[model samples]
Structures are given as C-alpha cells and as structure tokens.
Target: MSASAAGPDWGIFEGRTLSLLHPASMLGMAALSVSTALLGFQWRRQRTIGGEINELKAQLPNLNGAKTVSEALAAAQSAEMVDTSYV
Candidate 1:
C-alpha cells in the first residue's frame, strides 16, 4: 500500500503537526543547523592548519642547514669577539 493509504487518519497527527509548528521546534532546528555549519567550518580550518604544518615541517631541514652554517661562521669569528671585552 502507498504510505498515505497505510497510515492512520490525518487527524491523528494533528497534535504532532501543531507541535512542529511551534516556535521552539523551529528554534531548535535552526540551532542544530547552525551548530552543524560551525562544526564543518572548524573541521576545514583544522585540516588547513594541518596542511600548513606539514609544509613547514618539509622546509625544516633546509632551515636547519642554513642555521648550522651561520653558527659555524660565527664560531670561526670568535677571535674577534675575544678582543672586545664587556668589562
């Protein structure tokens, strides 16, 4: 049988229909929709952050190598530092 034909009389759902029409139900539905949207936005933001972190991690080796070279040069110039006393 079709859904409409198998169901109880329409009047049986009158109270439920009225309840659905109430403002609180509408507000609840709106809140649920907004919450779902916000959750999706937060998930997208987290994914973007993760992607950026991975990109930065991939660049770390080059950065570390450059820093090592700079430190080595500074260490070689330590004799210049020895001539300048804070005292």
Candidate 2:
C-alpha cells in the first residue's frame, strides 16, 4: 500500500533505529526468560527437598534426648520392651 495520503511517512527515531532495536529487544527477552526459568527451577528443587526432609521427619521417631551415639545405643539396649530405638 502507498503512504502518499499519510504525508511524508516520517517515523520517529529515524535511520535503522527500529530495525536495530528489534534484535536487541529479542535478545534481552530471551535472557530474561532463561533467567526466570532457572530461578523457578531452583525454587522447585528447594521445595522438593524441603518436602522430602519434612516427610523424613514425620516418619522417623525422635531420639529420647540422647546426646551421643554411644548413649543412644545404650538407652536402646536398656529398658526391656522399649522397641529398640536406632541412632
């Protein structure tokens, strides 16, 4: 279509500005998308690990206030019929 009726077709920012901007804008958008995706992946990974840790905490029983490994084992071996807690 001819722009004769539009009068002179003078666009803002003259000489290849729009053309140069297109590629630069596209590159910037690509970088933004990639960084956002990586951030999302990191968040998802942390959430998954956090959930797994929570599940483990829920499933396992607490050590009956024993500070050391030897003490814990000793407590488990003692007190008959206590189900034998592991360290």
Candidate 3:
C-alpha cells in the first residue's frame, strides 16, 4: 500500500514501523526523541571536556589540580612565566 493511503507513520526500525494514529501521541513521541538526542549530545560533550581536562593536567604538572579547562590553561600559562630579577 502507498504511504499516504496508509496515513502518516513513523518507521522505527528497518522493517518495523509505528502507525501514527493519534496526533497527541505523535507530538509527545517527537518531543521525547528530540530531548533524548539533546541529552546524548550533552553527555558526549561532557565526556570530551573531561578528557581534555585530564590531558591538560597530565601535560602540565603545575596545573594545581584545576577542574575546568580555562583554569587549567591559566595555571599552565602562569607556571611557564619567568620572574624578572636584577641585582
């Protein structure tokens, strides 16, 4: 059967499909899907940020146990600065 004749439906998997009968349910499912995708993105981003922080800490031993990326960078730069002194 043609798709339009069967009405609007969502294909969940390769062969399986969810017949969209109620508009409210469809809306709810769509909202849920979007939120879940956004959550996944945030989780991945958090992991990447954490990895970066760990790498920076390993590379710069003078980081002073900084938790965030900005703080780690600042500490690294400051640690590299040479103090000027004249006698």
lDDT for each of the candidates? 0.74, 0.80, 0.74
Candidate with the larger lDDT of 1 and 3? 3
lDDT of 3 at 43: 94
Q: Which stretches of candidate 2 lie over 4 Å from their true place?
A: 1-12, 54-70, 73-87
Tens digit per residue, CA lDDT, model 3, 40-80 = 99999987998899888788655468887799999889877
Clashing pairs in 3: none
Model 3 worst lDDT run, 10 consecutive residues: 10-19
Deviation from native of the Cα of residue 74 in model 3, angstroms: 16
Q: Tell me the tens digit of each residue's lDDT in model 1 across 1-87.
A: 577546556675656666677877889999999999999999999979988999898876443333576786666676457644664
**Candidate 3 residue runs with Cα over 4 Å from true position:** 1-21, 55-87
Candidate 2 structure lDDT: 0.80
Model 1 TM-score relative to the real fold: 0.43
* TM-score of every prediction relative to native: 0.43, 0.49, 0.39
Q: What's the ranking of the predictions by lDDT, best on top?
A: 2, 3, 1
- Stretches off by above 4 angstroms in model 1 are 1-21, 54-87
